[model samples]
Target: MNLEELLKSIIHQENELYNLYKLGETFATYELPSMVEHFKWLAGEELRHKRTIESFLEEDTLKGTAVIDYLDSLSLEPYFKDERAEPADLEDLILEALIREKHSYELYDRLSQILSGSLSDIFKMMRQEELKHAYRLKILYEMIGE
Candidate 1:
């Protein structure tokens, strides 16, 4: 895959993550105050990721080389495992987010090894951020006793 294709894939994944975070935020709002705040923070992080990917594309640094269809076929199921399972409470939501973040981190970390230049750095940074988010969610889950 070329740089442009890789960047586009990254952007697409970021958008997906943003949507999930929004859903999580909605779920969190109906729960305890602490959870509401935690989900909101996660949503903000997703937005930041979206902006970063957009900025990278806008710089014209990524060259489109690979076919879009082929890249799109890459399955993201592992990152979105709970898309079908409805969360029962704030703790459930936190656990779901933690799982998603961990999957994202693994995916991006693997992708980073194959990519080079700015795209590699971007993926590495995203993976790191996801790890942090996972850690935060884990802590929240423990605090909520679930």
Candidate 2:
């Protein structure tokens, strides 16, 4: 896949994670109130990231090869088999999210360096947001004594 297609696929995977997190929040039977709140907030932030990526695409003035199909095929569930099989404890979940965010940040950062113009800016912003998410997850993990 080309750069645009790869970026779109990343965004699509983020969207899937956003939805999964939302569902996880709804289904979670957290023993601690703070843990419940943390997951809910994380889910919201994931959705916010999804919206940010969508907005960036809308604002992209330069048209490139559209790759909606490739994006549509991506899923986040299979990436975390342990979490998918049995829901992790709050700290474990946060750490898992942090790892995912780190991977995404690295991917986007590499893409940003290779790309130029608005596309580069979009990837940079995405990488920044992923890092922010990772930071938040780390904080939450520490708070939960993980």
Candidate 3:
């Protein structure tokens, strides 16, 4: 779990989140009109995050193997729990998305604490975005009377 490995894992997790939000968008398109744009925006944000993480791989600063232990100890399972095959309940989806956003925020916050310089800055920004997503999800939940 070198820097490249860590970054690839982050990119993969971001892709999973992107898929989750895209599913949310699809479900919202048919069931919750007011939430359609919000889901789309979230999916777009995840894509952007993925691209940013991918960009790190091309940089020469990814030569460290010291972070391997931390990467190995990190659990991305919470962020990967998107039950795509489940029934399309808007409320349930939003709740799950909220949970995922919270987990993402926690992960990014921890990473920002452990890493310094550009990596720290990126994780901090990502953590903020996840917080925004959680806040918006809460508002959406209330708007839908859930």
TM-score of each: 0.69, 0.64, 0.82
- lDDT (10s digit) by residue, model 2, range 24-78: 4654454445555656776787677667666666676334423233334344234
C-alpha-based local distance difference test score of model 3? 0.77
As for lDDT, the candidate ahead, 1 or 3, is 3
Error of 3 at 119 (Å): 2.0
Q: How well does candidate 3 match the true structure in TM-score terms?
A: 0.82
> After superposition, which runs of candidate 3 have C-alpha atoms over 4 Å from their true positions?
1-3, 75-77, 80-87
Candidate closer to the true structure by TM-score (higher is better), 1 or 2: 1
Ranked candidates, highest TM-score first: 3, 1, 2
Candidate 1 lDDT, 51-121, residue by residue in tens: 88788678864445222334455454565343544566666666666776787797778656656776788
Number of the predicted model whose lDDT against the real structure is largest: 3
Query: What clash pairs does model 3 have?
Result: none
Screening candidate 1 with a backbone cut-off below 3 angstroms (N, C-alpha, C), the clashing residue pairs are none
What tens-digit string does per-residue lDDT give for candidate 3 at 51-79?
98787777744456334447766675665
